[model samples]
Target: MMGWDQLAAFVVVVAALIVVPGPSVLFVVSRGVALGRRAAVSTAVGNEAGMLVQVLLVAVGLGGIVERSALVFSVLKFAGALYLVHLGVHAWRHRKELAVTPEQERTTRSSAQILREGFIVGVSNPKGFLIFTAVLPQFVSPDSGSVPVQLLALGLICVIIALISDAAWGVLAGTVRGWLGHSPRRLSFIGGASGAVMVGLGVKLAFSSRP
Candidate 1:
């Protein structure tokens, strides 16, 4: 088992990592901002579950080669970027037609759908595997006793922080959306802006240098 001080330090580092605006965090926030807190949580949970698989694979060292392989990273990056672009384009196309009434938006999102969406967003991201493979091992010590346990602990910390942040975005978006229900045009613009941001991020990510 890891020492108390080590665990505490690990928690701090993991928490900071979670707070950073990475793909998972951004995906959850975007969902929350566009959907609702419940949907966000569903997405967060799914995303966490997706990440768990990556962490476990890394714990067993299955992902080490994948992480180091530029080809693998490039493939995943392009796929993820395309996914984001698709999502953005979809949002933009429908932005004008849908009325964002609370009742309507709330009714539209099933928990299952939210979870599935979150899972897809997290799984499709190539960066999470890289983080698990490259970044996670730096914190582990032979003295930690069980590397798997440590990895699990770190993954949980990340999930908790992501859930909190994403949930906040959902609540805020839902609230603002309700208040601004009268101006559908304004809401349409918001959707367009969000779509543009997603597309831009996708393009940037596709071209980003691997560490």
Candidate 2:
């Protein structure tokens, strides 16, 4: 069993890591602004779902393989970045259409589509996997009896924290988008800007130097 002190310490470290804005947060914000609170929340769920999967993989030892293999890491990295860029381009192309009344927006996307996009974005993000590989094991102790179980417990904690934090960001951005929606022109601007940000994130990730 993991000690209470270890668990509390782990919580603090994870909270600190999550509060800092990262790809997941940006993705949620983009979805919030582009779609709405519903979409944002859905995306957050899907992204965390992806995080959950990565954590599970780490618990099983697959994460270490990915971390050790430069080729694998690069492949995952580029694939995720390219996907983000694709989504960004798609958003830019349909910016005018996206800037619509709330009612009309609902018709533009189904729940499943939003969920799938969020899942893909979350799963593709190599950073989450890297964090699991690098950071999750640090808090674990051999004395814990079952390292895998402890990792899973810690991972779940991380996911819960992320869902709360990222969901808040989604709600906040969605509110701003709602306010901007009063003007069709401004709505269009927000959509385009969101797309631009997504593209920039993709490009940055694609070109980032591996550690």
State each model's CA lDDT, in order: 0.70, 0.85
User: What is the TM-score of each predicted model, taking all chains together?
Assistant: 0.86, 0.96
Q: Give, for candidate 1, the lowest lDDT window spanning 10 residues.
A: 29-38
lDDT tens readout by residue for model 2, 142-162? 886799888888888988998
Residue pairs with backbone overlap in model 2 = none
RMSD of 1: 2.3
Tens-place lDDT per residue, model 1, 61-179, is 66777777888778878887887788778767877744656677767657887777677677767767766776677777777578877776776665566667656656676576556
- Once fitted onto the true fold, the runs of candidate 2 whose alpha carbons sit more than 4 angstroms away are none
Q: After superposition, how far is residue 14 of candidate 1 from its true place, in Å?
A: 1.9
